[model samples]
Target: MAHDPITAVVPAFNESETIASVVAYLIRAPEVNEVIVVDNNSVDNTASVASTAGARVVTETRQGMGHAFKAGVAAAQNDWVMKVDADLERFGPRLVSCLANARAPGIGLVKGAWQDPGDDMPMTRLLVQPAVAALCPALAELTAPNSGIYLMDRSRIAHTELRGNYAVDLDAMLRMAWAGHGVAEVDIGQIENDRRSPAHYSAMAHEIMGFFLDCARASSKASST
Candidate 1:
């Protein structure tokens, strides 16, 4: 039986150290039709390494995760898109299987969730989820609303709205949920990411809160109009 092939979209910036391995793994996946690596103007050799690893390379000069991701998805050739973090090395075939198996009718996206050993998602625990609960309640239910790895439908997500900057993941999930698309989560076990600094969390909080405020203002204006 033939199954629909998925395009793996990886948005990267200065990820030469880890990209080759990630691309190699993705290219070897039977369900993955092609790996599209969007090089976000890296000062390193991410593009060349990705290409050598069997990924179709593209460039997104805008220099942000959102811009890189949009460019990668735009170049995707499959209906289903699997987006994984370029920096993370723990993602494996199990995570891919989990996300793929979660797809069903009316589902717009599948979130690949994993336990953080350090519990260091400070922005998510402190600000993002709280703001989402107030502005986009449905999105707050997600275990990892800020998760960088997930599978989405190209047709659905390509047309979806974006809040830009660091809030791309949250923005897409919020819009999809509001658009009557079902969200599913699959536990792919533990994936330990590096601990971020206080200043990093602060910047993330600013972007996330700004997005929520924009949503609040828009909602207020809509109701009044």
Candidate 2:
């Protein structure tokens, strides 16, 4: 089946070492119409390298994934938007599957979980998943609650407030489910990336937990009203 052209939105920060390869891989996908790289004020040559690799570059002076993504999506010209991390280039077949899942009926959001060859931070399994299960049970079904890659129908995620950093993925899931849309998770294969520092990981955990707590409070307030 033929699917609508897709715009792949990549949020990059100091990824000059691998941004070019990542953009090249995304651009090669037959389903992708354009690869928009939102350079998040990288001190490195990330923007120039990505542009050299054939991606249309946009500047998001903001230094957060959520900010970069918001800029990228807004710049996207297609109806379908796929969020990809600039450092993970193992997209090959996974890109095709994401596009297919996005085209599936009644599915407003498609999230990619790392499978064989893909590795995730301990925080994902230990914190993000369990917190969602406790506060937002509906979203606990996601195998990879912290996955960075997702294909969303533009309208479905419009105006959604994303968390600033690593918490973006978990926050996105919670928001999507809160908005009453179906979210599907798929194994997109391996993603090669270095682990973050323990301090950074802990910070991400704090944000994930905060998102859950905030959502719980919002739900409670809505119910009481």
Which candidate number would show the highest TM-score if scored against the true structure?
1
Candidate 1, overall lDDT? 0.81
What root-mean-square deviation over C-alphas does model 1 reach? 2.0
Give the per-residue lDDT digits (tens) of candidate 1, residues 1-225: 126789999999899999998888888778888999999989999999999889999998887788888788778888788888888776545877778778888888888889887876766778777877887677667777778798887676544346547878777777778778888788877887767678977777788778788889999999999
Models 1 onward score TM values of 0.93, 0.90
Candidate 1 regions with alpha-carbon error over 4 angstroms: 157-161
**Per-residue accuracy of model 2 over 147-167 as CA lDDT, tens digit each:** 778887767764346767667
Evaluated at residue 127, the lDDT of candidate 2 is 76
lDDT of 2: 0.77
**lDDT score, candidate 1, position 62:** 86
Q: Cα RMSDs of all predictions?
A: 2.0, 2.2
Q: Whole-model Cα lDDT per candidate?
A: 0.81, 0.77
Report model 1's TM-score to 2 decimal places: 0.93
